[model samples]
Target chain A: MVAHETLSRRSVGSDLRAMGAVAGKELTIARRYPSFLIAVLVWPVLLPLAYILGAKALAGPHGGSLPAFEAATGTTDYVGFIVIGTLLWGWLNMTLWDVGFFIRNEQMRGTLESNWLCPVPRGALLIGATLTKLALSLLFLVISIVEFRLLLGVNLLQGNLALTLLIIALIIPSIYGLGIAFASLVIRFKEANAMVFLVRGVFMIFAGMTFPIAVLPGWMQAVAMALPLTYAIAAMRAVVLNGAGLADIRGDLLALVAFGVALPIVGYLAFGHMARRARRHGDLGQY
Target chain B: MTATLSAPSWRSNLRAMTAIARKDFIQYLRYPMNAVFNVLQPLIWLTPVYFLGKTFASPVGNVGFAGYSGTTDYMSFILIGTVLANFITTVFWGMGYSLKTEMDAGVLESNWAAPVPRPVFLVGRTLASITITAAMSVVMLILGAWLFGFHVSGNVLAALGVAVPMLIALYGFGFAFAALVLLMRDANTMIDVSNFLVTLLSGSQFPVTVLPTLVLLVSLALPLTYGFDAVRGLLLGTNTLLPIPVEVLLLIVFMVVMVWVGLVVFRRVERRCRVLGTLNMH
Candidate 1:
């Protein structure tokens, strides 16, 4: 019985080591590709600056304190609103692409079959990739916030920082689950790039990443409500812009927790079923 | 040791270019889904901009956007900007990357051996891209007209007049950019960065005058600024930064200068690539 217990513990340790190895491999690859690293560091600044410039243009010479903007968004801090929206949208995009398209990337590089043959669980492999992407995305986010504060004079310390961090941390699990489910579709379809773009585009529209969902048409608002990102963004704005606390955002927090737990189970089952189907059809390495 | 053959006849060059364009069109059509997506892509991108405008729209008449852009109808203003952006992106990505794509596919050497001149081949690929982008633009305009009531209030012929010259200038700039891509031996990063920067600087979603003085100066240097102002002025009855005649003349000058510079640079790069034997390295 003691030997059996030790064997189980050893297996758990080995699984963790394999997961760490996978994540380390991804980091090494990213280091080798300097252009991609540069893009990661630079795009967050440029993309948000476009919107910030637009806000300035709309607000005229005074700043982003247009009365109409204040009426619609309930905040005169249009620059901060846009900066936060763009940053979160960028994070969502990186997560979706990095995690959802991981398998598709392997297939394109002719390594999918070998990866599937490995002893480590597929879920562990995906988790490692997601963790690496999460770390990189967080780093980029921090850098972008610093750049905005220094160059654009955006005030980053205005609201409930603890609550904002809590919302962000809670939303990540649901994003991972959604990404995993997206990966299953990619594995089934055998085309990653176009599908990734289409999915990302749909998310951009439905999630209301750049604007409030209330501005969306009624049907679109319904669709937005179903997305975990919708609640997360709303909660984030409440905390960061409105200075709302945990009690104020309890509903959204509960909804996010529900989605965070449910989606991973659904994603894992869907991926397992798709994998089996592909294996049966003898098309795992077709791409 | 024999004397080099004379340049191919103009008629032969035209025929070869047409053949290449036709081949590309056929290849493009094979993926019907791509065509459908292309038609929808602009609309997808426009959705958020539309909402953002509405969020800040003045309750009164033309006070918010018209105060800055000289047009109260933000939808038409943004739609035209989106169409122009599509054209610029096609020029940058489709034309600039054509040669690099050929090299990556291991066909650049074989294509170089063909009787056609390099300029004619490059122009053929660019023309194909222009045709596709123009179709997408038309689809976007029609969708806007049907769904959002975006009508052309100004002279249609006048708008076409402005657009034609601007397109020529844009193509000239694209040729220069294609030559630069050949010299650099990298396309992805350059194309992505330039595309983002140009889209941001061109005032596709707002008035350029609202930008900071420094950024406005940079915008003035971009050809798209003139094209955007002229096209919007003609199509949407908006005010142009400069008179129509001045804008048209500047566009023509840009076209002539850029095309000439493109040819010289492309020739130099061609010789360099031949000497270095790195045409297919990427």
Candidate 2:
């Protein structure tokens, strides 16, 4: 019994080490490439500015606090709305591209086979990548918030801060799960970039990143309802814009939790199935 | 006794340019799915912009957009801006990065050693890019008109006139941008930054009148601003910051200046790279 216990302890310790090593490796690579760092910093600022400027132009001297905007979003603080939306959307994108395209990147770098040879579980590898991306995305979000406040005069503090954080924490697991599922598809098809673009576009259109889902036609609303991000964004906006607390957003939280648990399991299964199929077909390195 | 060959005649240069364009066209055709994606990509990008416009649009009219944009048709306004923005992107990002791509593929050295002038080759690539961008623009216009009810009410031919000058100026600008990419030996970050800056300053999704005074001043200096304004004026009857004749003259001046600067910079960079022996470095 003691021997078995020790072995199990050793296995768990080694897995932890491996996961840390993978995450550290990603950070090192990012540090080596200044361009990636520049993109991470610049995109979060520039993308939101585009929309903010658009809103300002459209609002026509009233800035973004228009009655029409208030009627649709329940707040005339359009700058704040867009800033928060862009920050969260940026996180979602980073998670998707980092975790979802992880395998394809490995293949391109000619490291996929060697990575497969490692004793670490594939799930642990994914966890490592997801954690690193989450850290970077959080950093970007903070910087973006600062930029919006300083440059655009957006106020991010007027919200249920704790509840907003809670909603974001809940949403992240589902994003990881979706990333895993996308990574599986990318690995199987060798079309990671195109697939990521198509999926991101769908999310942008249906997930109500910059606007409310109610504005969409009924059929598109149905599609939005099916996406986990749709609920996350709604819950977040409710907490931030409407100052709703936990009780007000319980339904969205529960739905997100359900997605958080369910999608990862589906993703793990799908990845395992695809990996095995690729191995059988001897096509693991085809791309 | 050795016979010396004279510099290639204008006829030979023209022939070489046509040949290079044909080769690029054929190469592009080999990846048929990519061509489809190229056409579809702009539409995908326009979707979010459409929604953003819809979110603020008043139930009855354009929610004060008419005050700035002259036409209350927010959808058509954004569609026109986005289509023109895509063309600018094609010039700056697509054609501008073509040389970098050839270098990555290990063909730049051989191409440089060829008898043809480098500018001719660049012009050929630019022409091919223009053809592809024009086709994509047409498809986007049709898609917008059919699906989203985006209508062009004014003189289409006059709008084309504005677009033609804009394209010339953009091509001239792209040459200098391509030269910078060659010197840097990387295109990703440059392309991303330029794309964002151009989109922001060009009033692609909004009127320039709304920008901060400092930023508005900067926007006025860019050729894209004149081009965008002239095209919008003719197509949607939007108010222009300047008269159409003045805008066209500015575009022509920009075209000449940018082309001159682009050629000078390309030659200087090419000579420097050859001396440094970095032309073949990845």
Best by lDDT: 2
User: Model 2 segments beyond 4 Å from truth?
Assistant: A1-10, A62-65, B1-6
Model 2 interface Cα RMSD in Å: 2.0
**Candidate 1 lDDT, A103-184, residue by residue in tens:** 8888889898898788777778887877787788888878877887887777666688877778888887887888899889
lDDT at residue B271 of model 1 (Cα atoms): 84
Q: What is the DockQ of candidate 2?
A: 0.60
lDDT of 2 by residue, B185-256 (tens): 888788879887987798998899988899999999999899889989988889899998899899888888
Clashing pairs in 2: none
DockQ metric for all predictions: 0.52, 0.60
User: What i-RMS does every model get?
Assistant: 2.4, 2.0
In candidate 1, the residue pairs with backbone N, CA or C atoms under 3 Å apart (3 or more residues apart, or in different chains) clash, namely none
Taking the tens digit of each residue's C-alpha lDDT, what string does model 2 give over A63-84?
Answer: 4337777788887777777777
lDDT of 2: 0.81
